[model samples]
Target: MKPINLAAYFLCGSNRESFCDRFPSYFLRIFRSKECPPNEEYLLCGSACPFNCSNPRGPVLCTDDICGEGCYCKSGYLRNDNGTCVTMDQCVGKDEVCGPNEEFLSCGSVCPLTCKQPEPLVCGLACGMGCFCKAGYVRDTANDKCVTPDQCPTEQCLNQNEVYDLCNGNCEPSCDDPEPICTKICKGGCVCAPGLLRNSAGECVSVDKCGNYTDGALSQYMNVINKILHL
Candidate 1:
């Protein structure tokens, strides 16, 4: 190989003892290659992989991936949008705070619902801070949304696969959406079939019902918005 370019590599592995015989000045054994090589051809496999990281905050670490070993940012640091290490604080979102009976959080609403206790979260830490449900309202673990007990269907046999969802009494496959972008996963929203409507009793009646979809194309942002507006 080109020895001039070899100045950028380090001598390592069991072959180091032998490679150094021809290039004694460039030998670094297991350490970083701090010296440059002379201008000429030289054996290359005798050299070890070079790790010339420029991170000033921490030592370089190696982790295995499909491409073998890979470089990663040091602990408490993360790669930014530009692939540079930034302090952990930069990676973490700002704190958040809900309302009474809700929890205050440093992260945004999209963050996962978790608790600080050693055991599993009670009510799965059901409620979150900010615009929490009105008084006497609690979040339903089945759907992870806030609702008053009266909102739930009295039947208690409701689920995504049941004849009707407990929260909205819509038929199964309520979000019969064909749009690839919309999700069919129901999170307690209600929709009725054509020519049907949701009666005051919460049952689907003729031509007067409600509606609902899949995921990425649409979001439950409207659902939350409606909740905020008490719609």
Candidate 2:
């Protein structure tokens, strides 16, 4: 028997079997190596199943263990339904239009502000593509519409000294610390209106009225007033 040439045997043979089915995995890899499209590179033993916009992290369980030669998306890029490699930001269709007070995002926060949970304590890093409420607005679950935080149906503050605030801070002028340093985090609730301070009785009052509580309160009130007057 003549010495058989493996390359020639796989390429052309007098057999009815197809080249892919008849040849070994290595042989298929050698022939499949070719130039890849933009934003993609040829892989000799890449995953047959690749990540896409719909499944970013790829399938949890890919049963096919056989590695194949093909063009795959490069790092930071994902294959779209049309087989084109693109960045995560380009995954969403440009023609998609969002409703009023809403905007489309390629990756938006999973924990968006709603009427029930206006100020979320913690939000996850996981995101998804969809239409979300625009800045300075929250979703009103009652009517399923996006609106300003103030638009949500809630009790209006009856106290003339206090005002309903969409984003209240922890620090408020009080009988103790007239100037309290507060964190940037916002809390949706009622707070003392401008030019008012919370007295010892937990009621918002003018600086002059705080003196009625105690001498210490009066001294603090005077100090704040003097500082404001630059006297």
Candidate 3:
């Protein structure tokens, strides 16, 4: 005879014990004071058996056709307050949504698509232990949408780096450049002056190819110098 399933019998409760007592002696096993009973009718009830035990005699699949309604709904399924369909929204991270292939659950809400947060109502990029939203995004009303923190460009992006040195009205060392400026020195003890390049022997040569140092065009080279300087 098949071994009596103790767990199944326990779930079946007194119905299983009474059924065994009324039927075959092979359905019952006594070990010390413990009496194992045969399978009682497996009553697929509530959401726990949402597909109605998968038995042909089971009820059809419907959100409202939950077994054991108000009592149990499988592992993840929950009963609605009105006791109609299982509450799909209660799944949250548990089921996310009823999977397309499974008949156990129905659709509720699309899970929130944010990176790491499991609950659908949360917002913004999921952060590390100590990290906060950097700049461009902010915590929205639902705590969702790491939205543009401030109006674009009007207030400028927040400097995420804690320490900042200001150059004029902007951050120093320019975000794009590494160096500040290049200083020039002439080899022949001659002051080649700014706005000019030196030759091999240290003769100050106009960047424009040897014009007088006092030429009005020197101011133009000075402008170029300022353009290349980062800070």
Q: Write the per-residue lDDT of candidate 1 for residues 130-178, one digit (tens) a residue.
A: 2333345555545555556555443333323223333332232222221
Model 1 ranges off by over 4 Å: 1-68, 92-231
TM-score of each: 0.21, 0.46, 0.18
- RMSD to the native, candidate 2? 11.0
- lDDT of candidate 3 vs native? 0.33
Q: Per-model C-alpha lDDT, please?
A: 0.35, 0.69, 0.33
Q: Which parts of model 2 have CA positions greater than 4 angstroms off?
A: 1-98, 113-124, 135-137, 148-155, 212-221
RMSD of each: 18.0, 11.0, 20.7
Could you tell me how far off, in angstroms, the CA of residue 33 lies in candidate 3 after the best superposition? 26
| For model 2, the run of ten residues with the poorest summed lDDT | 1-10
Q: Estimate, for each residue in 119-205, the C-alpha lDDT of model 2 and write its tens digit.
A: 765666887545689989999878878999778987588777788665564567776656677765666577798878887888998
**How many steric clashes between backbone atoms does each model show?**
19, 0, 11
Candidate 1 local distance difference test against the native: 0.35
Error of 2 at 130 (Å): 2.8
Which rank order by TM-score, best down to worst?
Answer: 2, 1, 3
Task: Give the residue spans of candidate 3 off by over 4 A.
Answer: 1-71, 84-231
